[model samples]
Target: MKKETFLAFVALFLLTLTSVVYALEETTKTVTIAEQKADITGDRELDTILLKGVPYQDETDYLKQIFLEVSASNGTAYTIPLESGAKASFQLVDMNDDGVKDLFSSVQTGGSGGIVLSYLHSLKDNVLVDLPVPDPVEIDSHFLNGYQAEIKIKQTGKTYRFLLKDRKSYYKKLGLYYKGKLNEPTELMVNSYHSLKPITLKDGKLGLKGVQRVAGIANADTIAYVESTWAYLNGKWKLDNVKVLEKDQ
Candidate 1:
């Protein structure tokens, strides 16, 4: 082949290879940006926020580090620093009963189940401050009513009630339940309870209604246990009231 012909063929081949390389680079792209309206600052006004993250892949699954960007209506923007390895979720709740909503979110701390680590951003003087949850009692099931937060925990069959005082969550255990025959609490025992179906207190008694395991076997099917109520007397939850609907024989 002539010199000019050979040069022309080389140029065309290089152009086609570059195009393929560009297409391949575009296909494996992973970073993404998303936006949502949330009341992060505890103000009634809905603020615009952006979530910027990149896909992180591993042998089992994929996760991301979602960085939250809060934008004010007055053209001011702030970034709530979110670290790596933990996923985030956001919710607006009036935790202090101050008419304005507080920001609620959680970051996963390696548990596939049970309660993950959570964060409460309570608005202090129009600024969001990180209010850490009280240690030792992991959040099992929570019920938010106006300014009161009734939270149950894993292992224990008692409910912890917290009242919002002075723009913060305060759980004042009065040590009121002195007369009650309660079961010895065990960890991961009440895992069968439904999370979406909230267990509530009515007429001063919080009932425990769920299927119990047969002879406490690991893989055996559960049997319907009789209904029982935990009474709230004085200021603490008590298992003094037991109304057995069906005995677990």
Candidate 2:
């Protein structure tokens, strides 16, 4: 073989090797962000719970692939994949009142809306199953006349009105309103669960409370908050109550 051809072949091999190494570094990098010991299987023995994920390139705080790793005391291991986001964390609680501590996790999307993705899992009796989180409350919201906004909870047929006169100038500047009148019919922005956490119900059972934000025209536009309480009953999450409170502007 010619010397020039051999040198070209060597360069091509080096380039291919470099590409493969870079790909591996991007995909295979995993980090354990959180760890805890708890008796999740109801066996009275502590299990190792780990929250692991691969960080997005150049952003260590943002995970691209998040999951839960459990090393049960009964010689079993479980790996449960979860949605990717920033600031992934988990809590162990007996949410279902079944005497076994279930795993609940939340991940922040790091968006302007402050949206979060959450999950629930049961590791009881060495069986790994995902418990469903409560869905977002359906709402009908839009700009009202005279610099006001309205939100109606579809679940309970409750309506709420907000006096957004304080933001009239801001709204006018954004072409949303003109002289205290809406320029066009515009629906308010409703965001998913900004926060969901375990709360003790009045009956001493554990339940979940979620807070969702309602915005007008934009995310920062103040409107109101919709809080929903949920209870785990008969193997499903049941909505208990819905509350709509106006934002204190």
TM-score of each: 0.40, 0.90
Candidate 1 backbone clash number: 0
lDDT of 2 by residue, 144-228 (tens): 9998888889889988888877887888888988878878899999999989999998888899999999988778875788999
Off by over 4 Å in 1: 1-34, 38-45, 57-61, 83-87, 110-115, 123-125, 138-249
lDDT of 1: 0.43
lDDT of all predictions, in order shown? 0.43, 0.89
Clashing pairs in 2: none
Worst 10 residues of 2 by lDDT: 216-225
Candidate 2 lDDT score at position 126: 92
How would you encode candidate 1's per-residue C-alpha lDDT over 1-249 as one tens digit per residue? 999999999999999999999997775534435567855564456678665554554512334555566776555676665544345466666444455555555544343332244444565345766654323322343324333334343445555443333222221232211222112322222232111111345653232222221111122312223233333344333443322211234
Model 2 lDDT vs. the true structure?
Answer: 0.89
Total backbone clashes of candidate 2, pairs 3 or more residues apart or in separate chains? 0
